[model samples]
Target: MKKTSDLEEQLKEITQQRNLLLKALDVLEEGIHVVDSSGRTIIYTKGCEKIEQSKSDYILGKHISEAYELDDETSVQLRVLKSGIAVKNHHTSYITSQGKRADIITNTYPIFENGKIIAAVSVNRDITKLGELTEKIIELQKNLYSGEQKRRKHANGTIFEFDDIIGESDSIKQTIKIAKKFARSLSPVIIQGETGTGKELFAQSIHNYSSRANGPFVAVNCAAIPESLLEGILFGTSKGAFTGAEDKSGLFEEATEGTLFLDEINSMSMLLQTKMLRVLQNKTVRRVGGNKEIPVNPRIISATNVDPMESIAKNQLRNDLYYRLAVATLVIPPLRNRLDDIPILARYFIEKNSKIMGKNIKYISDEVFEIFNKYNWPGNVRELEHVIEHAINMADSTDTKLSVQHLPPHLREKFTHKHHFYKDYKVNNLQQTLLDIEKDIITQELINNDYNITKTAKSLGISRQHLQYRLKKLNIKKQK
Candidate 1:
């Protein structure tokens, strides 16, 4: 009786341990299945039922080939059972016995007893959502590329007109007059100016006012494109020219019967400049891999931030190309030279931004204007506009005007430093001291008035010619 009781106790303990192991397997998130050496299912978890969309009873005790309808090559467990080798992270798509499809990444390993294969166990994770996500990403990429291609195709469209340009200074007015005259002519035009001086604004205005207004207006930044690709971009390429090359129209062809505005023309490579000169002379283009010449009639309007003559001297721009592009030339004066226009431009920007930002700003404080007058605007009109926008955003909601407190931190610090420098200065030489003070005053007034030479001279109680002489004597080159 004692021996039988001991045997019964041992059997009960084994059953309890087996149940505990099975319970642990059932709690796993990944589907776990075990197959005997014959490839028949010996264990199946609830996770397997969820993954395969079938009950455990339908899988347990059934052959893997019968339960999952998998062949030797497709069934990971069967393959592991036959080879006694583990299949790590094998991916496959399968349909369950109940006709449910799933994409899964599975790991199947062979169980060993005394160095012989006893069974195979598999852990599976469904990756259907991951596959769907990959397809969505590919679709988004195609759409993005398509949109960019469309933008390039319609690149000739003008984004601004003559009325869009702001400023009433004589220098600006004269530039506009010249640009208007150039607009009526088909001769290629070259616009030269410093950075941030609204060169593109003038180019766009000229295009919009010209007879080509009805046609496309394509603009290209020569410096922005890689030298290796600029040639093909400007003249296009033919299919079979190289790997993945496609037959496409270049900017010149796209802007046919319209205007082709080449910005930063000085930055173009010499080889590209040679090709451009040829195109200008012949009024035709040949694709990169094509020998057939295609007639192109785009009115070229080129611009450079630096002096074209200087560019020619430095060999950065081809002399022949310069002469061709400079049939008419317009030089845009910099903001420091046009200080008298600052208030006008500032007020315009304030009102514009007020409407855009939904603010009730009605005025700009004199303190703000004082700071504006003292600061040298190296970035020109664009910088001024941005400053005003930033101030508006920083202004108090209840305040009806922008003040110095709302100015950029850099500008405030600069003003403070300059004030201290002037306040602590000790006059050692009377003439030199007076001259320094005069220069400082003139510079401030010039900035305050938006660099309008006429207004600045008048404000300083001197003639415009006198102001020009002082500017030269002071070694102050006009901003540009």
Candidate 2:
């Protein structure tokens, strides 16, 4: 009788332990399910009920196949039971008996009893929401970067406006006045300027000042894209047109009721020019492989570094296209032509760069301005901005003023050889002429060798120490 009572007590403890483990499994976020070797479900937690959208009462004692309507090949638990091998992070999609769809990632492991398959356990994670979120993120990225070769040239954003254009010169003012006037008109405007003369800046300013300011401002560089893809880029492609091609909107369609700025328009192919002329004439565009004509009403703003007339003469730009695009032409003068604005531009850039670089640059030396005015800036305003940024970075932390010492080695060399000797010679007597000439030659050699003391000395057929002495005597500081 005592043995029977002890056995009953032991069985009660085992059942309580099993119930505690089942309760623990039920609290987990991941679905926990166990099936016997015969494929009958032995355990089904509340998490499984939530994941499958079914009650445990229906699945706990039934065959997994009958309850979930899944086969041995589809059910991860049954696969593990049959194979005696664990399956880790297997993805599956299924429709539940209640008609609810679910995407799940599951891990299934077989239970071993003395090397014999007894049961299988599956841990399921419902990732339907995560999958939906991932899909949404991918779609947003596609919308931002979708095009042939993933070209984002016509991405919808503007970085500059009329107020951002920094120039007080009369020529720049006149250009701005014409650009403002062109903004009010829907006619296509052509901007001609040297590279880096802020052609795109004017395009953005016009877009911001126009009636289409609320819409997207798309910009594309004709020279940046391949010639073969220009047509499809300007006019969209339809599905079934080619392998891997989908129904895609071109820049013209994408910029509907907005502004489309085509930069370096002179680089467009002749065939594209003819197509563009037709679109400008009819204000309609047909896709590359489709016959349907789409009426696009976007404001056109084209820019070129080359002269439009010269481009036409060289067969680079179509005469008819030029005439249509140049209805309100705005020519931006180069930086050298507007020397009067250099001081203001320099001060503005200094302040701007100071804030960006966390510096306290208060002044630019007169010598620096003299060199800036003398150098012919082939790269224009953009080059000037870069030069200022370079100077700010080269300036000493303790120095509040930008000086010739902070200038780039090339500019410093040019300035030292060109102006410093002549100015000093004129002020001093004729006795210093020979010394000044020698100093100029030594300085030029030092610069040519990138301020290498040994190389400059060797090129001058002197010792490194002697060159150092000459540099100090000439009051020229070698950058450390």
Flag regions of model 2 displaced more than 4 Å.
1-156, 418-480
Candidate 1 lDDT by residue in tens digits, 110-208: 999999999999899876576455435433422333444446432445556778788888988888999999999888999999889998889888988
Query: What TM-score, over all chains together, does every model reach?
Result: 0.56, 0.58
Q: Which lDDT tens digits does candidate 2 get at residues 163-189? A: 888889998898899899999978899
lDDT value, candidate 1, whole model: 0.81
| Weakest ten-residue segment in model 2 by summed lDDT | 146-155
Query: In model 1, which regions exceed 4 Å deviation?
Result: 1-156, 418-480
Cα error of candidate 1 at position 189, Å: 0.3
